[model samples]
Target: MRKALALSLCAVLLGGCASNPADRDISGTWINQVAIDAAAKGGPLREALQAYGPNLEWDVNTKAAQARYTNGFENVEGKLLGEKPGAWAVDFYGSSATELKRDGKQLSQAASENEPEQVFDRAVIPVPEGAPIGASFERALYSAYMGGSWQVVSGNGEGNTVQFQADGQVTGLPGADRYALCLAGDCASMSGGNDSIWLQQGGQGNSWIFARKGKTLEIFQSVNTALADEMPSYTAGDRKWLLEKQ
Candidate 1:
């Protein structure tokens, strides 16, 4: 495989580098360009997919965000995003350090020119040897990168920030009909201060409070109604859910 040798080198570099939730610094958007490049045959990631972001938009194939630790390694043991598993019972790793473009969301860590090349393992990925590195590969990589990624987001350490990632776009509940239609293909908003953001699938009733603790984003959903589960339940968590970003 074109990237197999690259993957080996990345592992050698990342040895003994367990991530500290305190060391993560993912503010905006980040991408595994290796994965992204492998996926696109049409054009650049955003142009090929017709997606852009300040509030980055990602699909099953596109990783919406990531966290770059000071040591350049991200661990995805219990994260809510991206879920993929394969041979070797692998918990993957990437450069803890990364550079983001002023305009593009693609990450520039471990690129071909970097001191230590950016690479990942095919063996860690549970796919048939040499699966076509296309759309399916991108989505698979997303699950791999994000699923095991982290529940941490970068912040000012003020512990007053609120960052929530929609599990299914729009709260998907019975009351989200009023609060900004945040869907999988679109964008959403976050609130600040003592104010509670109104979220629901219908006439806006589910109130939510957000807080940041170091690398973790916490959402306390004040579900005054019974439509909670349908209202954007985490793919695998609860109301007092932990969030991640990069």
Candidate 2:
């Protein structure tokens, strides 16, 4: 009897396992749409479609959905429709999508054909206080050439400072013998040998200076020179250095 009971349990477990595969829900389609703003301008909708490749996915409801540029449609499973309800509206720059609505009703035909459509998610990073204004010219320079962490080596009340690190790093001063000079309320400048470094002083007195070397812009720390130059350029720009409050 125990042997029989054990066999029955095994069979039950196998049956449950067998049913799980069929229960899997792979029911969704990739939804593509055009930015209302872009569509209005008669710009190539293909540009908007290409931008969503990473964030968009289609399920195996029919076959793989391909975004086609020729038809100016998202081409989910190769179905075409007008700007009806159930159609998706895309924002290329934001990488997001919204459902189309006409009057008060969603286009039933489009929505029905493309059931279970996936919408792309959009992410935004807000500008922090003390962010550099205008062209990131100064920030770009520091990101390209200056290696290692750039800490504020020395600075007077005005703004002139020397930032150095243990990894044979020097930034701020431009030209061979020229040093960085910051005039408290005015502008900051760096001369490296013969090269002139561009300095952008924020309203708060925190400064971002960079020397132009070819196409790269090396970054330096405004206050913490010990921080490695390996820090991401965007992160460096986002940093709130301890300078005079704006």
Candidate 3:
């Protein structure tokens, strides 16, 4: 604790006031709060970072960060999560999806009238033989609502078709914002019928909640415990997917 304080103070005095990227961690959201905060308060580092004052979001599972720049349309935008202060500049556009694990034949969670749910056998979410899974599956739905050009950066995970535009943006995908990242470390399974996935985040001093259902997956979020966004973390929401093996 003392060492961290000293480092912060030394950097501030040096007139650079920056954290090293090599030592940065991703345990929370992508925003470099330490640096951005300094900038927002009109410190020496404000020019380069420009005070990240957008509706920020990200996926902890994939470590992808998104920043919604509102120059014109409020449809949402994407940007890579930065590692440190000085490196916190917009690279092209980027986003990410969340992930899962495996358990047995009991309802992973309960479904309520307010929250719809579905159940899969064993612990595998079945997608069409050629659909998508794992990281690839994550790609199809990641920060999709927070706009950006979507690209299938890797291979197939669970498998379902991901139709893309000539420019690589996804089309005819699930509901616009139907996705989630399990707040509890490495999640394994999701149950069905009014059953929703869980995500816990309260970065902006307000707890946000939302829900969506895909043709195969459904996601929603509801919680009271406020979460912080100091590292690579995610907000509260749900992501429901299928497990039909092709």
Which parts of model 2 have CA positions greater than 4 angstroms off?
17-19, 30-246
Once model 2 is optimally superposed onto the true structure by TM-score, how far is the C-alpha of residue 124 displaced, in angstroms?
22
Best by lDDT: 1
Please estimate how well model 3 matches the true structure, expressed as its whole-model Cα lDDT.
0.29
| Per-model TM-score versus the true fold | 0.19, 0.19, 0.16
Q: Which ten residues in a row have the lowest lDDT in candidate 1?
A: 53-62
Q: Model 1, stretches more than 4 Å misplaced?
A: 1-184, 187-214, 222-239, 242-246
Tens digits of per-residue lDDT, candidate 3, 1-246, equal: 999999988978885655443333322222222222333232222131223322122212225554332211133344544533322333334433111111222211123333222222221223344532222222322323213322222223324434422212344333322334321122311221122232222321222232322222322343323346423233444423332211
Model 2 CA lDDT for position 141: 20
Instruction: Give residue 238's lDDT in candidate 1 (0 to 100).
Output: 41
Residue lDDT tens for model 2, 1-246: 999999999999988777342232222322222222222232222233233321223222213222221112132233222223334332223433334322221121122332332232111222335532211211222222233333332332224344432122344433222223221112321211212222333322233443323222333444332346533221123322222211
| Model 1 agreement with the true structure over 24-74: per-residue lDDT tens digits | 322332333453333233222223222321112111111333332211111
- CA-lDDT, candidates in order: 0.32, 0.29, 0.29
